[model samples]
Target chain A: MKYATMRIISGAGERTLATITEVRSIAALFLHALHGCFRPSRALSASFFAQISRQILYTGVEAMGLVGIIAFFCGVTIVLQSMTTMPQFGVTEYFGNILVVAVVREMGPFFTSLVVIGRSGAALAAHIGTMRVNKEIDALEVMGIDPVHFVVVPALAGMTLSMICLNCYFDMIAIVGGLVIANVTVQVPFGIFLGKVLDALSWIDIVLSSSKGLVFGAVIAVVSCWYGMAVNNIRAVPQAAIRAVVGSMTVTIILNIVATVGFYAR
Target chain B: MPVKLEIDGIFWSAGVFPLLRGISLTVERGEIMVIGGRSGCGKSILLEICAGLKRPERGRIVWDDIDIATMSRNELLTARQRIGYVFQQYALIANYSIFENIALPLRSRGDLAEKEIDVRVHTVMEEVALFNVEKHFPESLSNGQLRAAALARALVTDPEMLFLDEPVSGLDPQTASGIRAVLHARQRRRERTIVTICHDLYLWASRPHRVAVLEGGKLVEPEENHAFRQMVEARR
Candidate 1:
């Protein structure tokens, strides 16, 4: 009994240490990538910027349609549900407040991040994992190319920018969907709905949403790239992709909860 | 003679099995050192350690008197720029075309204009006899072409020290001879220090190089081997 208890305790301790080590590694990689992005002395070459632009094109521009559809449906469902249910409580005037709280402050960044993680995060991890397996990363290092500066920085910058933009776009489209649904179902005046939304929205909501987007983007980029770089063989490529997706989603959701609680906690 | 590269008291292991044990060597400037070992030996790992690619369990890798193990990350990267390495697997970036792969090091240096890079890449390509494959990706190239392309990339920078891992292991005589000629020409032009891992020791008979065979987790002069002596006698 004593030996078994010691073994379990040791295993738990080992796992904790491993998790801490992994987190430290991710933080170091993130800081290095951030330094590369902002350092003018290491001014991004035209080619490097082109890489960043390509990442944005894939992660942001290409994701617009899916985000639009999801956001619209989400907004319609929430508004319809509110219209039907809130009248019982005589809280109809709070529709705009509900919409602002749910769509802008929370759902916009969270759902968009999920989409990005599903679409780009997995792909980034697989791409980088394949590069690692093929010794391409070693080749770059042998040629004196810092893989962090070359691969991670552009990805980090691009993903962060994409998340910010996509989050904003998602918010707008969902709000539009809400307006359309409200007008069509209950004949709510467009001006009145718009005024209510505007009245309830504040700069803090916008800042919080954008902040979530930025943090989630960095989380996905760092996590995906970290898993990818950790890959050692071809068999690990798909595993890396799966781990990246899971890791990105886990971290993003955790950050989402923390951000929400930190700002809104009473 | 001044030492250009030194490996001192190197030790490495994979899992529970130790691979290299207390291996040490010194290569003088402008000299070629060939490391030979059978399959599964730690020759490539030793070369990688010497090139600062993989850290050994216990060792000092000094390049031009600067201990690589002690250098900062950026310092090590900058130091690596003066060294070139050709992997046994011909590790060309799959997403890049042959021209782009050859031009990557130069582009990363951010020193030369595109035209100069173009000229240099083309020149090295010609030296390696890789023609009409500039736009081809690694997946599209044949084995010989891939090897030559890898060699071209390593040589394009004109690094002071070259580390080649099985540079000519799986090449036809023509391709292998062409590669040898390119290395010879480079050596003739400038006395670049080279360290190579080759399984076939017979290939080095025609060239002036020092051979060290890795066996039992240690390096020994090839002259002490019976097979080497028989090969030498047969040649005579």
Candidate 2:
């Protein structure tokens, strides 16, 4: 039993070290890719622009419906739960504020990032991992092209741009869902619900939420790119995908927490 | 101008396993040298090291009197820009059309107008005997056509030097000969220095200027270049 316990501990320590190494590599790749973009030749290339457009279409345009549906349902559920529980506590007057704060500040960024992590982050890792194993990265290097410039920058730009737009859209639609619930179930006027939500929301909320979306998008791109370029075998591709998704999601959640506390901690 | 390339006492290893030991060679301007070896004999590794994609553990690769190993990042990029490398697997971007793949090197320079890029790429395509397949992706190409496209991409920039790894190893005889003919024509026309890694020796109907063999982790010149030249001169 003692031997087994020691083995488990050792394994966990090795895993922790490996995770740190991975994070360092991802951060390095992110910085290098950003540096690559500062060179006008790389940043202004038709290939780079084309890659950005494709990524936008994939991560932003294709995922719009999924983000909307999830946001609307999330809003409706929160409103319903608050309506039932808050009235018993006689705090129902604060429901509009609760919904506005939660949906706009938290749910909007969290849900949109989760969608991109699942849909695009995994795909990014898998694609890059396959290319690494196949010597495509080596091919690029020999051709005097940095793979980071060709692969990661566009992904970074696409995810950030998409997430910011999607978060705003999610917030808007989610409020509509809450207004719908307010009008039909609670017998409140649509104008009242809209006015209350608008009152509770501030430019600060948009700024905070947009910043969260941008940071989360960058996290996903860097983590995905790092894992993807780390593969050496066929088995490693699936492993890379899993790690990329988990790492990006973890980073996003941690960033969300810190941002939340930093904004509200008075 | 075609620059002189020198590989001086290069040593490389894979973990504890030594792959290349004290391998040295000199490739003169406007000449072709084919390095032949068995499987896993570090043929590709040597090519990659010479291309500046991989650094040798111990040795200096002097390209036109500048040691590539000590060059800065931008210097390395500048050096690589003057050379073209063709991988055995073609390595064409699967999502890109043939025209785009061929135009990639030119596009990366960021100075060529679209018309210049189109003209140079099409001219190289014609040189490689590839026509009307510009819109097709790499996945849709035949083995021979893919090899042609790879060669076209390598030559489209009019690089001063060209390196190919197992370029014709997997193609049919007719297609293999066709590729060889195109390579020879390009070399003669452009005076581009060429280094090829080959597994099969029987296919060299038009033998290169020199033949070097990688064996026992060292590059050995067969003295065939001198002997073959003498024999040809004797015949003439």
Candidate 3:
């Protein structure tokens, strides 16, 4: 019995090692393809212009109104709730810092990733998955064009740039809307609220927020493309899209936690 | 134009099923070789091996004295540029305009100027009679148009050898015949070395200078059109 158990354990260990090696190799291939896609010298000016046009249409223009409404209401609600509670401790002055940290560093990246994942990530996965099912990827291979370079790179570049821009937009709207709410609803002077915002804001905070957004964008792009490529049939497209969004959101939140700890610890 | 493809004892498997077992074949320049078999007979696998997409477990694919199985990825890519592949599904990039789809391979070469690419693309599109539909997307195209667009893209680079995977399947009889006619015309015009996979024995009989029948993971004999058809019918 002891020898049999030992053999079984050894077999399982070998299987685990093989799985790990396969996963590592696939990860390395994905990273290499991503690197090729993002290399600046490979960017054709015409293709870049075309990608910018698509990004504006898909990410920026399509997402602006929804993000604007969400940010505005989020700011107002946070301020209203904070005012009701902070007066007990007379730490109402800390409201600006709380709002900035919560909204800018945490909520901003998280919400934007969620929105983009729902909108662009699903679309990207479905598009690419359909292309894969149709053998367009094989066609690219036959033509000697690396599908990663031609299809995936533009998407990563566009989404990363767009996510950063959206976060900035969200940040601007939320802070301004919070100031308005504090002035109108809480009877705080507009000048005092503005002064608090300016004082509480730091370059480090902006960098952290932008970094979070960048990571979220990368996660969404990579997960979407990975799932898209894995899809083999037409029926698998919707499931791949759903997986991309859910996977991106989950990774985004986890990464946010890690980033927050690292940023504050620094 | 003297392109030679020699596959020597190629062995392939999909997770130990052994799709192609020690398959060896050769196609000389200016010859049309039709790989005919029922579905799942590994004709596509053989074509993929020749295209360098599937590496044989233990064999060499030599193209004009160079073993493609041993080439570096970039070298394999360069070698692939000299071969045209028409996928069964007419794999035109959906998001791109037909012009852009044809232009994709040209852009990858990174050696051609934009002007040269445009000229080559236009010439090939004209050859395939797809010039008028260049602005349309693949999603908007009819089945015949899609196949033509795919063919135009395949032929754009003027590959020395062309591989067609079920080029006439899933089309109306009239449309399939028309595509076969176009393929025959193109072959005659260029005398290109072409390897096509098809189940339609009638179409295969009409065009191929040689026919290879794959059955049960083994390539059967005759390596000629008439004798191969006789063998196929006798088996049936």
Candidate 4:
């Protein structure tokens, strides 16, 4: 019994130590990426900017069609649910307020982030993991190139910029979808629905939603890249990609909840 | 400036299996040292440790009397800039074209303009006898072409020290001889130190200043015992 108790304690200690090491490593990686951003390295030549542009092209521009389709369907569903049920309770006049709060303040940033986490986050992790297995990262180190500066910084900057822009794009598409669905389903005029949405929307709501996108982007990039860098062999690439997706989604949801509570709890 | 490498009392292990046990060796400036051993006998691991690519569990690796273990990350990178390395597997970036792969070191240094980089990369490619494949990526290249590209990248910087792992493996006899000639000419033109790991002994018989055998996790000089003669005869 005593020996078993000792083994249990030892296992717990090892797990705690591993967790601490993981957190410290992630924090160090984040700081290095930030430093590369502010002061910049000599490697930040035209090629560096080209890398950032390429990342933006992959994570932002290429993902537009998917984000647009998802946003439109979500908008239509939300508006249909609200318009059909809200009038029976005599709260139809507050339709504008409900739509703005639900779509702009909450759903816009959240759903867009989920899409990015699924697509870009998994891809980033898999790419880096494959590089590590092939010893390409070591090759870069041998050439006196900082992988964090050359790889992670561009990814971080591009993902953040993409998230902010995609959030805005998602908001516009969803509202348009809502307007069309409202007019077609309930015979409500498009102008009145749009006017209500515009009236209920505030600059604060836009700022807060954009802020959530920014944070979510940084979190996804850091976590995915961290998992990618941790891979040591070929077998770990798919595992790292899966872990990156799950980790990014979990963190994004928790942060979304925190942002909502922090902003409105007062 | 030429640098002398000194490795002392190195101990390394993988998962409780000791691969190198208190191994030590040194190579002077401008010397060619070839380490030979059977496959999976930790020859590559020792070369990697000497090149500062992997840290040993206990030892000091010094370049020109400066201990590499004490150097900061940037300082270590600065030191590594004076060194060139070629991996056994090529390890070329999949996304980069051949020209970009060869020019990466120069681009990272950021001292020379694009014109100088282009000139230097072309020169090295020519020296390696690789032509007209500059725009192609690694995936499209043959094994010989890939090896040539990797060697060209290593030599583009004109480094003072070169650490090559099986640089001539998997090539025909003529291609292998050509690679050896290129390395010999480069070393003769400039006082460059080279440490190579190869299992093929006859390939490097006439070139290296010294040949050492790694067996039983210890490095032994060629003249130390009968095992050296046995290794050479085995290769023959």
Using all chains and alpha carbons, the TM-scores for the candidates as numbered come to 0.94, 0.92, 0.88, 0.96
Identify the leading candidate in terms of lDDT.
1
Give lDDT for model 1.
0.90
Model 3 DockQ vs. reference: 0.59
The alpha-carbon deviation from the true structure for residue A170 of candidate 2, after best TM-score superposition, in angstroms, is 1.6
Top-DockQ structure, candidate number: 4
lDDT of 4 by residue, A1-266 (tens): 99999999999999999978987887799899989878667654666788888888988999899999988987898898898889899888777787788888899899898889999999999999998988788888898888898878888888999999999999999998988898898888988898889999999999998999899988888889999999998999999999999988988999899999999897
- Give the least accurate 10-residue stretch of model 1 chain A, judged by summed lDDT: A39-48
- What candidate 2 gets wrong by more than 4 Å, as runs, is A1-18, A38-44, B222-236
lDDT at position A28, candidate 2: 90
Q: Model 1: residues >4 Å from true position, as ranges?
A: A40-44, B1-3, B226-236
Winner by TM-score: 4
- Residues A1-266 of candidate 3 have per-residue lDDT tens digits of 99999999999999999767744643664586568655732424466558656965797678999888888887887888888998898877788888888788888888888889999999888888988888888787778767776667777778888899999899888888898999898688888998888788899889988998887887787778877887888999999999888877777888888998888798
Candidate 1, residues A1-266, lDDT tens digits: the string is 99999999999999999999999999999998899888722423765888889999999999999999999998899899999999999888988989999999999999999999999999999999988988999999998898888899889999999999999999999999999999999999989999999999999999999999999999999999999999998999999999999989999988999998999785
Q: iRMS for model 2?
A: 1.8
Give the worst 10-residue stretch by lDDT in candidate 1 chain B: B200-209
Q: Over the stretch A57-159, how does candidate 2's per-residue lDDT look in tens digits?
A: 9999999999999989888988898899998998877777888788989999999999999999999999999888777787777778778888888888887
- Ranking of models by DockQ: 4, 1, 3, 2
